[model samples]
Structure formats: C-alpha cells, structure tokens
Target: MNIQLNQKSDKPIYEQLKSEIIRLIMCKELREGESLLSMRALAKDLGISVITTKRAYKELEDLGYINSVPGKGTFVAKGNQTMIREQSLRRLELKIKESIELSRQLSIERSEYADIVEFLWEE
Candidate 1:
C-alpha cells in the first residue's frame, strides 16, 4: 500500500496510516472496491501494533473511506469524494489557522502572509 510511518513524528502512527491511505485513495492509487491488507498483516508489514492498524481501519471505515465485511476483508468505499474533499478542507483550514496565529505572534503583516501563500501556491 506504500504506507510509510515516521517514528519520530509528533503525529501518532495510526493517524499517519490513515492519512497515507486517504492520500492514496484521493490520488486514485486505491480505487473503489480495492481490497486492503488485513489489520494483522498491515501491522506486521509496517512493524506497528495490531491495535494501531485496527484503530486506523476503524477510523477510515467511520469516515466512509473504506468498508469492512465480517470474515471477508476491507475494501475502498465508493462515492466518497465529497467526504474526502471536506476532510481535506478541514485539515487545511486548521493548518492555516495555526499559521495565522504564528504570524500574529511574530508581527507579520497579512499582505506578507498572502504573498508567501501565493508564492507557495505557484511553486
């Protein structure tokens, strides 16, 4: 699944896993109905705990990004674009809010912040 976890990251492993899976789905690398590895298998592959994989899978399922079938396996859910887009926007908004707070603390002007954003957007 091309999932990568950073042990040194401040984010939890399960959150990283969830984000990677979502990124793959958003990038069309994981199509609708595509089966995912079992939680145990993924934990072994990623060198993480089964509990971590379970938590990630549960969150993904709750978010409508994937589905679990008893005795079967997990598969990507269909028609989840809207949900995915909303989630992405929420994350971006949170990040922007943090940046705005930091800029205020540093006395950076709004125009300068906008310029930086524009430069990054064009990069």
Candidate 2:
C-alpha cells in the first residue's frame, strides 16, 4: 500500500490515507480478500499515530470495504466490483460538488476552473 500525505493540504492526513486506500481497492490494486497491514504496522510505516490509522480503518469497515476479526487482521471485503465502482464514483461526485461550491465562492472563472479540472483528470 502506498500513501502520500501532503502536510500543507487542508485535508486531514488520515482522510488522505483513507481515500488512497479506497481508490486502490476500487482500481483492483488492492484486490478483494487481500489482507491489509495491521493498524500498528501502518502507523509505524506512515509515522502517524495508531489512533489515526484506526479511525481510517474503522471508516472503511463501516463502509463495507474491509472486515476485521478480533484475532485475525483486517482484510479487503469481497463483492461485486461494479457495485464498488458505483459507490466510489458516487463519493467522487459528492466531493466534486463540494469543490464546485468552493470555486463559486472564490469567483473562479469557468474556463479557469475547467483548465484545473482538466489537469487533474489528466493526472
């Protein structure tokens, strides 16, 4: 698993971690039934607190992305990839809405916004 945290971004570090993992899962980089690194392991690797990792993992579990066992480690949940893709796209749409609202507040020109959006899509 690879996560890059932007210290200057407004987004929380944990959320950055969470979103990257979800994207990986949706992209099949983290396949169904693949076991994730334990919370302790991830925290150590990321140099973040265990609490942050736990919170991200908890959210993933609540959203049905992963399953946790008391003795066993957390593993990716198996399901229809189409359904997961739909769910992920929905989340992206909602985030896009938020970004659009912010753009409006900042009085960003439609052309300028489109350019930025195009760059991100290309990336």
Candidate 3:
C-alpha cells in the first residue's frame, strides 16, 4: 500500500492517511483479510505520531472498513457488500453535488451538464 502525506495541506495528517487507505481498499490494492501495519510502524513510516495512525485505524474500524483481532493485528474487514456499496454511492453523490454546484456557478445549461455526465459515464 502506498500513501503520501502533505504536511502543508489544510487537511489533517490522520485524515489524509485514512483517505488514502480507504482509497486503496476500494481499489482492491489492499484486499480483504490483508493485514495492515501496526500503528507505530505506520506512524514511523509516515513520520507522524502513533496517535494519528491510531485515530485513523479507529475511524476505519468504526466504518467497517477494517477490524482488529486480539493478539494478531488489524486486517481489512470481510465482505460488507452493503456498507461498501453505500460508501461508493456516497462518494458518487458528493461528486455529483460538486459538479452541480460548479455547473450552476458557470451558468451551464442542464442539457449540457447531462451530456457531459453521459459522455464521462460512457468513457
């Protein structure tokens, strides 16, 4: 798994890490049941505190993207198809919302926006 952190970005370090990990999982780069590095190890690798990594893991666990097994380690959660679909849909919805806002700001016609969406969808 590859994650790049930007200390200069407005986003928090932990949030950036969490988002990259989620993206990896969604892209199947990190498969189900694959073990993740320990919080300390990840923090060291990213040059951040363990607390930041722990928070990211905790949030991922709460979202059902991963789970922790006692005495073992953290692994990607088993198939939660419904949850996964919901997450994917949420991301699509947010993108659509942003597109709508931008189109409105640019005074783009509805039909033109629809054509753009359809064109992208077909690609």
- Residue 53 displacement in candidate 1 (angstroms): 0.6
Q: Between the candidate structures 1 and 3, which one is better when assessed by lDDT?
A: 1
lDDT of 3 by residue, 46-102 (tens): 899999999999999988899999899999999875778698789789999999999
lDDT of 1: 0.94
- Write model 2 residue lDDT over 27-58, tens digit each, in one string: 78999999999999999999999999999999
| TM-scores for every predicted model | 0.80, 0.83, 0.74
lDDT of candidate model 2 versus the reference: 0.90
lDDT of 1 by residue, 1-123 (tens): 998889999999999999999999999999999999999999999999999999999999998899999999999998758877798889889999999999999999999999999999998
- Scored against the true structure, residue 92 in model 2 reaches a CA lDDT of 84
Best by TM-score: 2
User: Model 3: which residue pairs collide?
Assistant: none
Model 2 off-target regions past 4 Å?
A: 101-109, 120-123
Candidate 1 ranges beyond 4 A from true positions: 111-123
In candidate 1, position 73 carries an lDDT of: 96
Computed on alpha carbons, the lDDT of every model, listed in order, comes to: 0.94, 0.90, 0.92
